[model samples]
Target chain A: MSGSDASATTLGEASERETLKRIFPRLPESRSTIVGPGDDAAVLAAPDGRYVVTTDMMVHGPDFRWAWSAPYDLGWKAAATNLSDVAAMGAVPTALVVAIAAPASTPVSDLEELADGLRDGCAALAPGCGVVGGDLSVSDTFTIAVTAFGDLEGRAPVLRSGARVGDVVAVSGMLGAAATGLRLLFSEAVDAAGEPDRARFERVLAAHPETVTAQLRPRPPIADGPLAAQAGATAMLDLSDGLALDARRVAEASGVGIDLDPGLLGDDVEIALTGGEDHGLFAAFPAGAGLPGGFRAIGVVVPGAGVLVGGRPFDERGGWDPYIGWDGHGG
Target chain B: MSGSDASATTLGEASERETLKRIFPRLPESRSTIVGPGDDAAVLAAPDGRYVVTTDMMVHGPDFRWAWSAPYDLGWKAAATNLSDVAAMGAVPTALVVAIAAPASTPVSDLEELADGLRDGCAALAPGCGVVGGDLSVSDTFTIAVTAFGDLEGRAPVLRSGARVGDVVAVSGMLGAAATGLRLLFSEAVDAAGEPDRARFERVLAAHPETVTAQLRPRPPIADGPLAAQAGATAMLDLSDGLALDARRVAEASGVGIDLDPGLLGDDVEIALTGGEDHGLFAAFPAGAGLPGGFRAIGVVVPGAGVLVGGRPFDERGGWDPYIGWDGHGG
Candidate 1:
């Protein structure tokens, strides 16, 4: 994305200090930031005495593609995904620290757009949260690692191992949409490179803006984390590794089997069950306990092992692992 | 670096879960880690009510060369560099979260050795602090981003902006040795690819194991951070960007000029001024506040601007900036 100012400088033409000066004002400021960027270390007040911390990294090739996303969307997706991890623990995200490693040839304008997206993402979804610190370096490829800190507000962290046998399995927000969107993006990329499927692909891309956004920059139900905690969620996690893999994780951790109902999940049950990158919340509520608004019950916990479908293990597998990149081919 | 085990598997041959499982047992376990690696997010207890946070990343080509470093050294360096940041804040580090992005061609056993380095580094330096969580992904260039958390134990952080004009500036440990070692490594890399300079190069390399270690895997004086704070250091920071540049930072932050003494630092004063990556403690103490062990007085703060030697700015410069890799060339 180009700026309105003519003759924008690329990051290659600037000094390290100059690059930092240009990006400083673009980051959102947070109230919890007692000592923001430009210090030996940042001091943030943890009023509740305890905080939750999680970190994730996105690489250029394995995590995303420039053809599929703009610098802004990349920044937004990075922030949103890390935010979802914190919210999964029943906490309010307070601060973010990002480390960006990019090739020197990258345009400085792109970094500015990335900064704007980071600020905008927090403002639109997790307000009051801001980027507190950053470290930049040169690398052969671009990679962003983000660590998010959140306040639990005296509540116990909702762990993945807290589910009981009688808990009702549910999900919050969109599911499988990101995976579907990813498939279309891959198809579009292939189409652009080879034979033209422009008309059909255009209809697919133009008709599903939400799906495109989901695959590119997902806005998970951040608020539902606290609501689930308040409603006594027995177990909780973000559906990043697809429902099947992540459900099995919670089950193994909590020592219970997840009995998923394909019929109850409506028509997109296949995607909901196996598609990853949804960034939606996966939680368990006691059998009779009330679920927060926007939550849909899709399964239940039973005394057994692994994730189940139709009261038995599925013959088909659903999930995306990084070893196999976007093409489902080994790296 | 390849492992001693001949049958070691490359990461391309393993799944993400399998890769993680192979490395999990090698990480050191921390008592503060209520939940360790393997979950969606590891849960850590912040018993002191507040924590000090800092992050740093090391890229392969720009930060270090595999020719000069082993996988063990790479892991150790990554952990040491970040631990130094937490200690710079006068906080004892408690936990570490690392996200590693590497190519598929990297060996799984190399990662295991990397994990061993991580655990050993923490055990040898910041005892009781251990690796808590990790996020693994595929990338073209291998990068390790480490975020370290520390407990302040109720003392207000000693910021870089707290130095007074009358304060005495002191530093702990060696300076410039790492830079000198880096030059040697570069020459060696160039020599290996070009004409031979074997005799002299071998002598230069073999004569300075400490310097080589400083460049490839530095174990800085981490304990000096709290010792400085206990000695009533008013302003503090670690020397990563050379003495001149970093001194200017503290000077600008505290609004005070610094007058350094070349003679006071003894014979290695030139290296002391321009050499960085020493990871030594640079602290400003109220004049005659009784300096701690190993910390030598090197300069004094004065009312002016920037850094000065003999009341004049030095003609030489030494430092590392990402935009310009080792040669300080932008892009």
Candidate 2:
């Protein structure tokens, strides 16, 4: 493909404009963004009239290894990770800033491919939100940092706190795909060991295509966050940590108890409870309110002190913990 | 000092609370910011408007090193570096998002100290801005990336291509203190090769205290950028690359020549001509207009190519250049 072509042959085939086209339609409208994307600096209305912002860093070797992912995939994943934080707060994403550090020997084509992926990632979730400003520095290793902005749109922001007894619990995206994909990519089981051999790795990839994609490129449920807020979501958060752990955060924050139904989780119990990097919306709503579109009913708020799964304490064997590295049941 | 009490220090002090306080003043009065700095996510005014944004990264050992400065100094310098880019395009800085990556063994106090310095740096310039969100990740070394946002106040942004011949050149803020200070810091003439020579360094430090401070903490003339716009600056840019090199950018952008008067620079010849990191405003105004306050006549526009200093070609000498290492002068 030519340099400017929009083909998907090699990762470099896509251009920034092509990526933007794919992602822009998904974002909701917001008034605070006077000039959304495509500029030196984005102009926000700050109508409430203030702006809330934050940033996060992802380094290649420390954060992710190239052996398991491509540069474009890395770019998309990085953007999604930061944007998910913005979406978690019941806010509308407005703009994103990116800083990339890479070895000078890195191919310019790879850089362009990364930009294409970033444009696609942002547009897919926040439409019309382009990287407005950035700094490119040379380093020995590849590192990316993204700063994200959001607008509250005149509604009270739903925080980790505010979950209460009798509240219905819901989630707006899939679970465990990322963790499963990661295991397939990193585990020795896929390398030279295990009963099934290398062919099993291909079987895993074929069986869970969506899960593999989820690990490569997370799509933050940007629109559902605001919709949930409009539907009176009492408490909300992005499920970056496993559902069980993140739910514990909400329970602790609101000073309440959470009881999750393992039966409701279906056959993928481990994925539902301990899978992370879902970028899915997990929220608590008033009992009578209808669950918004795209959300699955998962559990209920209760008057207790901690998180429970199937009427038992959800321990590490059945949950996710960043420190211990997400070894749960069935994995 | 106690945390809350120390929070009162300016954002330049690099403390957590001060980061919030500095941003509080600049935020537009809006109800959307329900849970601002102290929360996991800040509520904002996203009222049907789109948002624009960008991000940049600075890595220690590559972008900077501790042997050259303190943690707080690094904090201040990092914030200033990104803020300059936002202000360069005639935008009002609003919010900042930061991500820091460091070794697991890195001291938490050092991180706090860095935060204090970042707070102080932002407060010194771009007051009323606050750090809204961030993520801390472990890496082999220290790195900081910042994403900054600005409001355009609904005007078409002034770009680099608006200059015309016969326009006069003006500058706001100092010229070369940073470059000079850097020279003093790394030279064997100022200190013995391996001895802990505080006294020797102090003499060098005292001789050009402003320059040393400028290198450690750059204060971009952000207010003057808008003033230049209002004063009808034909073309403008922040002096990041050395003046001569930066002049070439404006010249290439506008297709005009910049003729500088070295004799006009007062008492700091080396800094006036080749120094970098001044973060001063360099603008082109129509000839015969009285220059604005805080601005001084340094050059004039002509109808030709590139830049000239004292009727000769202006050789590029100072500024941060990637190829020649941090302290080397590049031609």
Candidate 2 colliding pairs, count: 36
Off by over 4 Å in 2: A1-52, A151-156, A189-208, A268-271, A311-331, B1-34, B38-40, B44-54, B152-157, B189-208, B266-273, B286-290, B310-320, B323-331
Candidates in order, TM-scores: namely 0.94, 0.80
Q: For each candidate, what is chain B's TM-score?
A: 0.91, 0.79
Off by over 4 Å in 1: A1-7, A192-204, A325-331, B1-7, B192-204, B315-317, B325-331
**Per-residue lDDT tens digits of candidate 2, residues A189-254?**
244532223455456567777877787777778888878888999999888768887888899889
Task: Give the range where candidate 2 chain A is weakest over 10 consecutive residues by summed lDDT.
Answer: A322-331
Candidate 1, pairs of clashing residues: A11-A108
- Residue-level lDDT for A237 in candidate 1: 95
- Per-model DockQ against the true two-chain complex: 0.60, 0.30
lDDT of 1 at B48: 63
The deviation in Å at residue A247 for candidate 1 is: 1.1
Top candidate when judged by TM-score against the true structure? 1
